[model samples]
Target: MDDLLSGLRMPERVAPGALFLPGYAASIEREALRGIAAICALAPPHHLLTPGGRRLSVAMTGCGAFGWHSDRAGYRYVSRDPVSGRPWPAMPRSWRDLAREAAERAGYPGFEPQSCLVNRYDTGARMGLHRDCDEDDLTSPVVSVSFGVTAAFLFGGAERHDPVRKLAVESGDVLVWGGPSRLAYHGVAPLPRRTHSLTGPLRWNLTFRRVTHRQGP
Candidate 1:
């Protein structure tokens, strides 16, 4: 069964109210990667330290009205960037379109996102199992899209100890979670290093959300 499942395509997301859709960006790989590159040019990915004073290995940057931050203080979203003191880059149309489309497919409508967290994963980068509890609005769904090399997506139950479903997230795949499954513990496993024509040596994930707090100028 393990072999059969592995051979299966990206599964239909089954997280109650959570929605997952895979987009084939193969037709526009160049544009998609270029959009990501442009965003990186605006705000390069950097290792961020958690409140526990531990620095994450993945290079990350955010583009949108609100960006997620984790530091000595804690993990939260802020308006202006602590580094540039300016607003984070805006979500590119491709990113926004993919997010909105995923949300709609997931049965959530009118999802206007104000934040797009872009994370870059190299060979060993992995985001441990965690719940997205920082958002003020739990009603809004979280939309995540994968591009470049494939990775294992860990989607667990509400509790930390519950069993999890491992899904293979490939480039152009979108996952949406909300309603009953909004807070399910989810994250990426260690990414195997591989080169792609577009993303080269890494995989990119764009997480879109409607942040609870409003951004300031």
Candidate 2:
């Protein structure tokens, strides 16, 4: 949002778009406050409907070229933001830099993310396992950065029958998944009742993706 649009840079962590890495973005972590400030400017995290009317406890917002939204109509992304009926705030330069570095570190090159889904978690908020298939393009990998509170990142295989791998993610951690790992069902388990200095009693997750509404390469 307007309040968070400070143009800052974290030259430490920059990468391509395929390989998944963790804890290599300390500079980005320090600059996260700036990014959060910007996200709050556009769409503050608000519990949204799950199409079935179930209220999600986590506050969800977004930045970049498109923002993700879900309602009774189903899940999708568009140029216009549902909240202000204006376009989602442009992805901050900090985000772009980090994603590029993380992607490159993970082995992918030239990763340009157009959508950044911001998920804010309160003490008890949790997200169930779900595959991110709304993007018309499944070939692109997903790059995510964890901030604030610590939690378990559940990374599952393609089939539900396949067990999940729980990875402990603390602040300033980045995860990248593509190729066979891209379609894996991943989610955040409930945050234990805890608080932090920078993040307070919450968890902030920034997931960057390249979404194609109707077509892709």
Candidate 3:
């Protein structure tokens, strides 16, 4: 991992224990996209219903031992896809390696993620600011990888109403947050009308999390 980090550009510190690594995944773009395609083919992407019964703007799917899901019952992780009633596709090794590498580069080493939630955003799609506190462990950092299109990321304090710092993130960017900033509120702004050679009009975000400390999917 040290050798790989040496080839990438230096990461910018977003906050205490938070890092924004621009183009950090550029070298693995092809493998990452391929892995996403394979995972979605089996599980497919669908908008999830929030506890309020509102449909999410972003289409979501995932691979790994546990997949994040929500539908009126509140947010949680499941071992299978609710839509297909099948075990969520296995996370690709390449995806796992990339996530670990990114986390290590950001100073959060030993991030063994059990979930990789993939969000697909199109024009006008957005995710409201929220904290990732549903994980079984809070010590592990959240590593996010972006592919296709460009979006504004809202990084805020622990409180939802706190001031937010917006950052423009392009394809191949990777952001990791943990430690003091582990539960910080963050999200993506509505995407503008745009297209990328790899994802067309869609923006892909893969978030890796250590969902559970125990075994079994």
Best by TM-score: 3
Steric overlap count per candidate: 1, 15, 0
lDDT of model number 3: 0.90
Give residue 107's error in model 2 in angstroms. Answer: 2.0
lDDT tens per residue, model 3, 35-80: 8898889989999999999999999999998899999999999998
Q: Which stretches of candidate 2 lie over 4 Å from their true place?
A: 1-20, 213-217
Query: Which digits, one per residue and each the tens of the lDDT, describe model 2 over residues 1-217?
Result: 5326622322222222323355666667767767787778767778889899888878889888888888888778877678788888888887888887777767666778889989998888888998887876676678888888888878787876678777667788788887667777878889988887887888899998889733442
Better-scoring candidate (lDDT), 1 or 3: 3
Badly placed stretches (over 4 Å) of model 1 are: 1-11, 24-28, 213-217
What clash pairs does model 1 have?
19-176
Between candidates 2 and 3, the TM-score winner: 3
Candidate 3 lDDT at 83 equals: 93
Error of 3 at 47 (Å): 0.4
The positional error of residue 201 in candidate 2, measured at the CA in angstroms, is 0.9
If both were scored by lDDT, which would come out higher, candidate 1 or candidate 2?
1
lDDT of 1 by residue, 94-212 (tens): 76776777788788887778899889998889999999998877888998888898999999989999898888887887789999999999988999878876677799988889886
Lowest-sum lDDT 10-residue window in model 2? 6-15
If scored against the real structure, what TM-score would every candidate get? Answer: 0.91, 0.87, 0.93
Worst 10-residue lDDT window, candidate 3: 2-11
